[model samples]
Target: MSEMQDYRSSLSDPKSRKFETFSYLPEMTQDNIYKQVKYIVSRGWNPAIEHTEPEQAFNHYWYMWKLPMFGEADVDKILAEADACHKAHPNHHIRLVAYDNYKQSQGAAMVIYRGPIKV
Candidate 1:
């Protein structure tokens, strides 16, 4: 198979409107969400949960609610909070962002799980 393309660069919108990467999921479940969070934590990166409102769909910035600086031990708590956020904002866009504390830059993985697009 041919190599996958990095479409982020081809986006016509401003860089602010683009997601961290194309590694986003159309839907997110508890099992998969936990697994992704666990994997991110295992890599020694800090996990932060962010969400955007319908009015802010094009907003480049997301509001961070739950940020667990702990390691794998905090997986359950982080996942629990994520679940809560999803439940509360069933129609909003939610995502898990992993940041490298040492590098102070966002990791390549930006897992997004959101409800069906309106319109």
Candidate 2:
């Protein structure tokens, strides 16, 4: 199995979920999404192409219907959508993550935070 699948399989236990990490490129540009899809497909994940709005791209394998973050975008809208969707698809829990691609100039190359939410 590829590295991504191996890593994801290792995370099979939800309670064991640790700090999620990934190398996301400059937002969800078409190119970046394509690359993400490639990684998914290579991992033997057949993602659903029947995408609806808000959840621009989705994969049942990851239990996530991602709403891509464009350049200089606010994640509040996406987070709200995920919250609503989370209620509808309780079995497939959703989480929101942001990618600040070119924000390296902000001197905030990487960030980590902790908080409690009723997931």
TM-score, per-candidate, Cα-based: 0.66, 0.32
Candidate 2, residues 21-106, lDDT tens digits: the string is: 43232224434444544443343332321122222112333433543433312234433454565555544433333333344221
Cα displacement (Å) at residue 61, model 1: 0.9
lDDT of 1 by residue, 1-119 (tens): 99985545322443224444453334455676677777787778877778877456556787776564445457887777777888888877677777888898876355465555444
User: Ten-residue segment with the worst summed lDDT in candidate 1?
Assistant: 9-18
Q: Candidate 1 clashing pairs?
A: none
Give model 1 RMSD, 1 decimal: 4.7
Tell me, by lDDT, which candidate is best. Answer: 1
Cα error, residue 27 of model 2, in Å, equals 27
Q: Please report how far candidate 1 places residue 95 from its true position, in Å.
A: 0.8
Each candidate: what lDDT? 0.65, 0.34
Alpha-carbon error at 91 in model 1, in Å?
1.8
